[model samples]
Each structure stands twice: as C-alpha cells, then as structure tokens.
Target: MLNTQHYPQMISPSLMGEWIVIASEQEFVQRQQIKTCLDGQTLTLHRDTINGVHVYQVNFESLDMKELNLSVQAAYGFVWLCIGSEKKPLFQLQEYDVEGARRVPCGAYGVRTSPLRGIENFLDMAHFPYVHTGILGAEPETTVKPYKVEWREDVDEIWATECFFTQPLAAPSSPQPQETEYVYRVASPLNAILYKVNTAAEGIIPADVVCLFIQPLSETHIRAHLLMILDDQTSSMTDMVLFQQKIFTQDKPILENHVPLKLPLEKLEIPTKADALATAYRKWLITKNWCYGVHKNTQEEQVV
Candidate 1:
C-alpha cells in the first residue's frame, strides 16, 4: 500500500462513489481541521483569530475557506437540487432498493443523489429574489445590497434578506398551538441560525445558534445537520410549519429536475459579475479538490 501514513486525512466517497480525501491538520490536540472542495476548486484555508485561540471560519460571501462540515455540505446539496434543472432519481432511505445497493447510514437529513452537477450558480439565488420574492425579494435593492456587505477575517458578514428585518411587519394572529416550533439554518460546524416565520412576513428573530454538522454519504452525496436553540416559548406551530412547507415546496419541484452530469469544474469559462458568489464558492471548493461545475482557472499544486 502507498504509505498513507504521511497523509492523515478524512476519507469518504461522493454520492457517485468517487473517492475523496479531506486533507487537513489540527493546531492543538482538541482543535481539529478539515477541508472541502467546491466546484472542483481547492481553497487555501487559514486560522481565524477569535477571542484568542484559532477557530474555523469561511466567508461564503467572499469565497474564503477554513474548515469542513458535513451539515453545511448537505444544506448546499439540498438547495442545489431544489433549483437545478437536470433530472436524476433520488430516494430517501425509506424508499431505496435494498438488494440493488447497500444502504449507507447518513446524517440527520440522510443522503440522496449528489445535486452538485449541472447547476447554474446564481440562478438559485435569483430564484429567491423572484419566487419567495414576497418577504426577502420585496425589492430589487435588497437582492443586491447584501452583496455589498463588508467582511472581517473573524466574523463573516451575512446579510440574509430572510433575517434582515427584526421587527414584525404584520400583526400577530390568534392563539397558536401548544408545542414550541423552531427553524434552524446552519452553514458550518460552529455557526447556526434559528427562528420561526409566522403571520405574513413576521415572526421572532433568530436569537441563538446551536450547532452544525456535516457528513458524507457516498461518492457524490453529503449530509448537513443543524441545531438551534429557541429564545422563548411560544404557540406558533401552524405558522412555522406553513413557512417551512412553503419554502421547501417551492424548491422541491425545481430541485428534482436537475440533470445528472459532472463538469470539469477546472475547465469552466471565465466568470462574470453574476458569478461573484460562485467565483468565491469555487475557490472554497478547490481546497477539497472536488467540485461540480466547470472552472476555467486551475491552481497548479507545487510538488517540490
């Protein structure tokens, strides 16, 4: 066997069963480091200075890479599938063929076909601008404002139109159900966002972030898990459920039609203004050395 000892990294397969290695290191015994590639672009990761010690951080807004998390990967895949036009048959664990292929246990959301290929990067974000256009994309300005948000090395500035307005824009409804409801949106192992959407475009603010998890299912599939802490008790089950369904349902049909094809991400044409986020996203993906879309620029790894 080739001496794998020198390369101590996490290994897994993509949904298509392609082998992958997350080459990374740890600063201290307790601190761990992981890497990921997006759209076939490798990212140069570095330590972020928090209070004092080093911590993992990435600015998706700026295309910076730091650490790897499975939960975030799943979130990316989930949204990617919901928006892309390529078609592929994906099944949940409950609906898989046991004899045809071995079932691999995945993360909280579980695994499905990889949705990274054949996707138009900005179109998905643009969908949010026009489709869910009610609350978030209320205006053309909001769609582009967040792009101008500044960033710091330690704190990644996120200007989510979803969380932009804190106070409710609508009046509260009648008494809600008994159970407390919450929605969690996480992007990495350390960061998370939580809240509920009730009334027209009104609800409580996302107060506390809980945890983030990312895991791989197969050669092309990955899972991203997120946890959130509720700030207060409430009776908003109906409102929250409706919100989740509305958002997810709108995305489901769009995602299910994605074509099953992988691009030589490294061979893509030069990016343009619309691809600002994708440009950054590609850089981050390169660090992992595996991504879905075509890329014109490829960094030559120096083998000295």
Candidate 2:
C-alpha cells in the first residue's frame, strides 16, 4: 500500500458519481499497483496483464482488500476512478485528437489545499502578471477585460470566453511577447481547462489546450494532474515540461497559504471585475447543491 488509513472530513454525496483523476496512465503502466484513498477510505489500483485494471478498497471490518465492482478508465493519458453507482461520462477534449499536436501528460503534482481552490487558481488570469511574472504575464497590462461567462445547459459546463491577456512568454515556443486569448472551461468543480491562442502576424493557429484534472486526496489535499495538447513543434519536450512545472510551482505556495483552506460558499471576500470567472464558478456550485470541499463563512473551520 502506498498510503495508510484516511480520517478526513467525509466527501459529500453531491460529489459522488463524478470521475476523478487517480493517477497518470503511464505511472500505472510502469508500476502495476498504486494504492491511495478516496472518500475517506483507502483504495488500491492494480493493473494486470490478464485481469486488466482492478480497484480494491480497504474492507473496514477485516482490514483486507476487496475488489470494487466499478471499472477504471484511461482518457487523455490519465487513469480515472468514479465513486458511485451512477457514473457521468468524462468531459470531451477534441483538442486531444488534433493532428500534429504534442500531447504532454506532466504527471501529478501535490498541493495542500482544496481541489476547488486549485481549479479556481487555474481559472484566474489576473494572477499571471504577479504569480507567474515574465512568463505568463507582465506589468502595465494586468487589466482583465470584461469577458463572457455562461453556463452551457447542454454540456453542463461553465465557460468563460473573450478573455485576453498580454504575456511576455506565452509558451515554450514563443519568440516574443503577444496578446493571448483564452477560453476557460470548468468541466466539473475539480476539473478545468484553458485553451490558449496567442496572437500571430501571419496565420491563424489552433489554441493550445491545457487541462488540470484534480485528484482530491481529501478535502484539503490534492494531486494536480496537468495534461496539455499543444500545436508547437519547435520546443523540446524538456522545455515544455519545465515551463509547466515552473508555472505551477510558483502558484503552489500561494494556494497553500489560503486562510480557509477549503473554499467558502458564502460572500467572505470581496471580488473585483477580474474575478468574474471565479464568481460564476461559485454560483454554479451553489446551483448544483455541491457541498464537497466547500465551507460557509458562518461556520468556522479550524486552521491547522
């Protein structure tokens, strides 16, 4: 077993039946067994040549492993596990099938914070000039212009479009600074992706898709699995990986320092225009009655 028994705040019922990223597909392919926890119970993922992948949860009574009935799935180079009787289909990523695009599954990066907070941090554009300075954004152009935020009924996704920001280095292959357009999509409370299209002088290009599939170890612990499908052919694989690692490492400390730890469902802090997407994200959670990893200001939490 990779970890021991979990005794965290119980994951809410509303968050069930949803697909959660468990581990990188390659990780399991390399190491057959990956043991972890979910919903306050310990889980072991075993991949075999004959039986395929089997998930076993710790039997509380006997402290023995009992195989779960549900099956594990592989999508976009990552393994996923669903926790309830009813499982929703994983979100679609058309960018993954695009020809000539580079697929980079950078593996899991741990963060000691709420999964909601992790996703919210990825959706914010205002922090770029400060948090990821000189690479994602720069000074004097930090204004987050008015963007369109909508809840697509058909897809059940929160979409934020018409978002633009000036970046000193938008991608590993970028030669100069440019104005970048972004379309941020929140597939679920813990899963989000942003399509980045940098301004070009000659031809139109497909946006590079960057996805954050969060694995909630508990209410406060998370494994941020970053997957990217890019149109760049010039940059080396090492450069692309380093660029992403650099960006996320910069945001790690800030995410961990959040006072509440879990996202507050109430109006605890005042948000400005730049937080339009984040504001809409919270409202969407309220509509679904999602209670996982969320707290209210009236109810205080003990900070450890």
Candidate 3:
C-alpha cells in the first residue's frame, strides 16, 4: 500500500486501481538506489533480481523507515509501481499488447506543471500545427475536424474518435506526409492512450499505440512516462526515441507555463469544438470527486 498521507491527491481511491511510473528500468539498474520525494516525504527505490526476475524494493521515510514489500518490475523497459490492492484489476487494455510493436521508452521527463495539465496537453491535437510545427503538424492545415467524444458505458472509459490530422513526419520511418486518423482514450485520470493510423508504408498499419503515464509528485509537479508501441519495420529504436523526444521538448515550455497550475473544472473562456475530449476529461475528474490537484478561484469552492 502507498503512503496516502504523503500523496493524498495521487493515492485517492479514484486512482487506486491505476499503475504509476516510478523510474525507468535503465535508471534503476544504473543508479541501484533511486531516490524520489513525494508529498514532502522521501522514497528510496532499490533494485533486486530474484531467480533472474528483476524486482524493486521501496523504503519510505515517513512510514518510520518501514520497507514496502513491493516488487517493482519493467514492462517494455518502464519501471512501474502500483498503489492499489492485488485484487483490483489493472487499467491496462488489450490495445497495449501489441505483439511486434517496438517499445520506445521516453525517459521520465520532469515538468513543473500539474499532472492533469500534462495529460490535457497530450489530448490536445490543435497545438500540433503551432507547437510541433513541421514534425507533427504544419500551417494551412490547422483546422481541427469535429470528433466524437463520449463515456463508454461498457468499459467505464472516455473515448474520442474520428480525429484526423495531416502531418509531415508522423513517425520516424515515414517518407512522406500522410493523413493520420486517431482515437484517444483516457484510461484513468493520470493515464491516457492514443491509437493512431500509421500510413507511411504500403498497406497502412491500422493502429500504433502510445501510452502516457504521469506521476504527480505534488499539485504543481509531475513526471511524464511515455511508451510508444509502434509498427514501424524501419528506423532504429534510438532514432525513434530521439524523434519522440524532440516533439516533447517542444511541448515542455508550453506545458510548464500553463496558467493557474491546477486544472479548472469550470467553463472556459474560449471553449471550442476541438476541445471536446478535454471537456469530457474534466467532467470525468469532477465525477470522481478528485479535486486535490484542481484549482478554484474562491476558497469556498476549493476541494482541498
């Protein structure tokens, strides 16, 4: 179990069933002991291999030096830590189980922004043309088409589909520009998955998945853990990782500077049809009664 007193906003029951990224497998292997501060408390993570299976042991300072018997492991080169009970189902979906998809691990990048803000920015496609420029989007193709957004009753997840965008370099192996179709899923408040059409090759691939898992250290700090499950038969893993890093590098400044750090659940001043997914996400957070990382103008309206 996680120390909820140290991470009340992140350890809420609403997010108990979700998995959080603590460190990369490489980071743990290289450092041996990884130290992180969460909610003003220090957590030291140590790596161990049991019967040739990699695992991690975590020690919390606030818990009176008690060692958590958690066995952290790497899935697709990411070090994952769970906060919930063993009986609860994980937030993973079948889409993430791509057999031949190359895993490109984008190391945990720190940002002085709310975790919700990082996710909301990832869900925003309109910024590609301006922020990502020629890589993801470009000028004259800036219009965002209307997409469908709804809560899936069967899975209890929010989805947005029918999203199409023209991109110059949608993937590292692409030779020319293509029209990319996308489907976005908010698996949880701190997790999001994107399924995109890979059209750079003959017989375009139906879907290439990218998962974003965010760790909220505080109300105003977060670390983005990105994993890309791609279908590219070309391009080396190093090339793919560099390409993805450049895109996020461009997004970092914009994300870090977002006003009012915490997300606002109220109506926006200039809400557009393109913001449908973000709107739905905000509604979902409100429904879950998750307000620790949210902001309200009046003290009486705050949830903390």
lDDT against true structure, model 2: 0.79
Models ranked on TM-score: 2, 3, 1
Better model by TM-score: candidate 2 vs candidate 3? 2
For each of the candidates, the C-alpha root-mean-square deviation to the true structure, in angstroms, is 16.2, 4.8, 3.7
Poorly placed runs, candidate 1 (over 4 Å): 1-10, 13-124, 131-143, 146-214, 222-235, 260-264, 267-275, 288-304
Best by TM-score: 2
- lDDT, candidate 2, 1-304, per-residue tens: 1111251333346556688877776776567777765645566676656465444322222233333234467778877766445445889998787667789887788898888899999999999989988998888888888999999978889999999888999988888998898999999878999999844312223688899999887778888999888887777898888889999999999999998898987888789999999999999999988877786676776432
lDDT of 3 by residue, 1-304 (tens): 5555664433444444456667778686567788885544468888887898887877766655332234355665666665445323346655445566666777778888878999999999999999999988999999999999999867678999999999998988878998899999987778799998887533333577788888777767888888887888788889988988898889899987777777888764357888989989999888878765676767533211
Ten residues in sequence with the least summed lDDT for candidate 3? 63-72
Angstrom error of the Cα, residue 224, model 2: value is 0.6
Error of 2 at 105 (Å): 1.0
**TM-score of each model, paired residue for residue:** 0.39, 0.88, 0.86
Hey, what RMSD does candidate 3 come out at?
A: 3.7
Per-residue lDDT value at 6 in model 3: 69
**Stretches of model 3 off by over 4 angstroms after superposition:** 1-17, 64-74, 84-88, 93-99, 201-205, 299-304
**Model 2: what TM-score?**
0.88
Q: Which tens-of-lDDT digit does each residue in 167-282 have in candidate 1?
A: 21111232332112223232221123333443322223323222223333332343333222222234254553344345444554444343332233453456655444445444
lDDT order, best first, reads 2, 3, 1
